[model samples]
Target: MMIPLAPATIAAPFARYSHGVEVPAGWRLAVCSGQLGMASDGTVPESPREQADCCFANIAAILAEAQMTLTDIVRINAYVTDRAHMQGYMDSRDAHVGTPPPASTLMIVSGFTRPEFKVEIEVIAAAP
Candidate 1:
């Protein structure tokens, strides 16, 4: 199982995330690579919200395939090409993951491997 942590001495997280996460030893884990806004057929969406939706969907699909779910995720790393897209990222993410969310980091990047790519998300999850 994973436990999200945010101590009183630390600043509260800016969004739907925790400051740290704890996963006990011996639990099965999955570390996902950066997932872009590509559909299963390799099509990239133009809108940031659409892309964010696709990104989380892809992440969820990966976890599902491994017999896990979003609730099991411990850490999340999000990268976006522009600051303007952050709202969409946060909104989409909050829609997918539940309360006391995983420890997370969000970055604004200059660009991506593909110019059309607006966001990339990476995740680490532990089995219960």
Candidate 2:
């Protein structure tokens, strides 16, 4: 099992995520490419929350190909086009991640390749 690290010397995480995670030896790792908010049907949602949901769904599918699931995720890197979309992204993340939540970071970017895209997510997972 992975170990969550939250040092007492530091402040608690600002959101539903761990500050770090320790993947044990002998576990296999999967690094997924960043996933955009577009659905397989080639449609992008107008709302940030919806877009983020799509992004996580895509990530889940990618992990499934490797015989893993969202609970195996150890880290997440996410980007949003605007600060206003942060809450929306966070909500989706909280819904999908497993207990003791993975270490995470969210950033605001100028934009994506597509103007309509509001969120993108990538993750690192490990499983024995």
Taking all chains together, the TM-score of candidate 2 against the true structure is 0.98
Q: What overall lDDT, based on C-alpha atoms, would model 1 receive against the true structure?
A: 0.88
Q: What is the number of backbone collisions in each predicted candidate, taken in the order shown?
A: 0, 0
Task: Give the alpha-carbon lDDT of every model.
Answer: 0.88, 0.95
In candidate 2, how many Å is residue 128 off?
Answer: 0.8
lDDT by residue (tens digit), candidate 1, 19-125: 99888888999898899998998899898878988988898999998898888888899999999999998988888876668889999999899899999999998
| TM-score of every candidate | 0.93, 0.98
Candidate 2 per-residue lDDT, tens place, 30-53, comes to 999999999999999999999999
User: Looking at candidate 1, what is the lDDT of residue 98?
Assistant: 65
lDDT value, residue 31 of candidate 2? 95
